[model samples]
Target: MTFNLLLSLSIALTLVAAAPGPGVIMTVTRTLQFGLTAGLLVVAGIVAMDLVVLMATLAGLNLLTLANQPGLLTLLMVIASLVLIVLGIQSWRRPIILRLDEGHASVSHFMAGIAVSLTNPVLFYLAFLPVFIDLDALTLHDQIVLLALISGVLTLVLGAYALLAAKLKTWLFEQHPERQLWLNRISATVLFILAITLIHSTIS
Candidate 1:
């Protein structure tokens, strides 16, 4: 049962990671602007926050279930949708400027990553985590293992996105400056689509 639960959770996390969200956008932005190193730093910050949230959820902040808090999930969906739309618009309007300087901004990149992830309620739904398995049925050891596996899977998924963006930075953007702007527009469009989807889900 424990193994089954782990597998289920891993699949769910993979799907979630693949979905366009703040963390993915942050990773793409950092990679496009700074390079692979900065992108990795942003991913580290995101994963750190995700672990913190998971720990909180395991510690009984199972707010994701919305069992106790009426309308909380809907509220989160609405807020997240609005935020995504704003982010998308902002990205669409921002000029594509590449800053590969290595002197500073690493800390800011990391913190921005964390802040983006934490603010995205769509990513770490407190109710979503507990839906895969019965937390009460699991022993403390089981819970720890589940969380650890989740963290690992999350890192791999987000890391893949970072690497892909970094590769594109050199392969496409370096050769053609306009490519970055197009990429930014594409990312922004994805964000808008995600926001629309969330809103529809909330209403439906």
Candidate 2:
């Protein structure tokens, strides 16, 4: 990837990371139910699993390229765009529900974290990352660099959330319950706009 493209993808990934989604909610819930240590472990697990997903996505994309499946790329772009749009709209309309108390009653925080991160739609969205990067053209070294950058950024963002949840548990869960919803809507709007831009580019 070009330096500029890598930078852009990094920014996009960071923005996605900042969004208040299932993974973030789970991270905060684990902090409240367990402790800061557990929460950080959860965050660690999340990052590790996401990296695995990213690798799988890259391998699958490479195989598609080897098979000369250009249509699959276009189809993925459309599907991903629609998914983002739908998710954004749903988030915008959904009511906020603070359910920290509803977290897993008996499970290892780290294990739960890995499970959530792996199943998280946002992480799976990495499958469509080729919409931004030329996956087929990327050398193994280039892929490693991009993956490392993504993992680093994801760790930073999720770690910040874990720290905040650990430090301000009561304030976040009690005093500012609605903040999560507000952040979710904002993130959703951004995703919607991004999807629209992608669609427009595809059509053009």
Candidate 3:
């Protein structure tokens, strides 16, 4: 990848990653509930999903193809919506209890993060957009390098956000747990709305 190409990809990835979506909400909630370690694990899962989506898009399974397979896309989106709704409701009901003694690090928590990340369609869409935009111009070696660079940038951006959320957990919970609940609810509502919009768009 040329410098210009890399710079463009980095800028695009940064903007996409910075956008507040289901992944962001999940990372924040996991960080608050389980700590930074868990949030990072979720970040890993998200990155993995991005890789899969990007690869698929590069292989010509573009958004248009997905749109054409409305039955599959609709099913996936509905499943994802249900997962987001359940997660949001659970986060609202349960207060985050920090276990300082045991330390907040576990494979299970990391896996949970991955599961949450995999369930969100918005992440797939974001990953697909960049692949659609950049894949055709690069040679095979450059494509591999570009994919690695993009993935690395995304991982770093997401990890930073997860770490920031973990760092802010104390202040966030202390100030108002109810506020976090409200935020989770709002995030969940947005997720559902997006899911509906995607379905409608696909069908139309």
Candidate 4:
């Protein structure tokens, strides 16, 4: 990718990833509950979902196609909204904790992250893959380069969040065990709002 293209992509991706959304909330929750290691695993899951969405979009299974389909987009929005609501309610009802005896930290955290990340369609439409589509003028090699840079920057930015979460985990656990629940509610709220907005946009 050209430097300018790479620079633009980096800036855009940073802003998108840095935004307070479901992924960010998940990372923070994981960090507070488990630690940096678990949070990083969540980040990996989010990135993996991004790659999947990108590939799907590139292969013609895009949001636009769903939007064009009569009820598909609306259904997706409804399902996503419901998932967020359930997650929010669940978070509100439970204390977020790290069960050290449950299983291997890495596997458990990664699996949870992957599951949570896959539930949000907005991540694909709002975040990473859009950058690739938007920069379609670039050659394949340049596109790959740009994607790599974007992913690398995202990893760093997200990893930093995980580290911060790990550092603050003790404080969060001690002072406010309910902090994770609050974060979950906030994340769910955002997701719910996005779902409604998406449905409205699709129908209009």
Candidate 3 C-alpha lDDT tens digits along 12-120: 8788788887567767666766677778877887787667666766666656566566566556555654554555455556553433322456665454444455445
Candidate 2 residues 48-139, lDDT tens each? 77776677677764533422444654565566567556656755775655664433333355665664553344335445586787767779
lDDT ranking, high to low: 1, 2, 3, 4
Error of 1 at 166 (Å): 0.9
- Ranking of all predicted structures according to TM-score, beginning with the best and ending with the worst: 3, 1, 4, 2
The prediction achieving the highest TM-score against the true structure is: 3
Q: Judged by lDDT against the true structure, how good is candidate 1?
A: 0.70
The root-mean-square deviation over C-alpha atoms between each candidate and the true structure, in angstroms, is: 4.8, 9.0, 4.2, 4.8
Candidate 4 C-alpha lDDT tens digits along 1-204: 557756776788889788876678778875665567778888887787666566555445666666567774457545545554555455455556544222136665565455455555533554554554563454677546755775687688888888887777676556666566676566556545544554465465
Candidate 2: 10-residue stretch with minimal lDDT: 61-70
**TM-score against truth, every candidate:** 0.67, 0.59, 0.71, 0.65
Best by lDDT: 1
Residue 82, model 3, lDDT: 57
- Candidate 2's C-alpha runs over 4 A off are 61-107, 122-127, 170-204
lDDT of each: 0.70, 0.66, 0.63, 0.63
- In model 1, pairs of residues that clash are 64-126, 64-127, 65-127
Model 2 gets an lDDT of 0.66
Two-way TM-score contest, 1 vs 2, winner: 1
The TM-score of candidate 3 is 0.71
Q: How accurate is candidate 3 locally (lDDT)?
A: 0.63
Q: What number of clashing residue pairs does each candidate have, in the order they appear?
A: 3, 0, 1, 0
Clashing pairs in 2: none
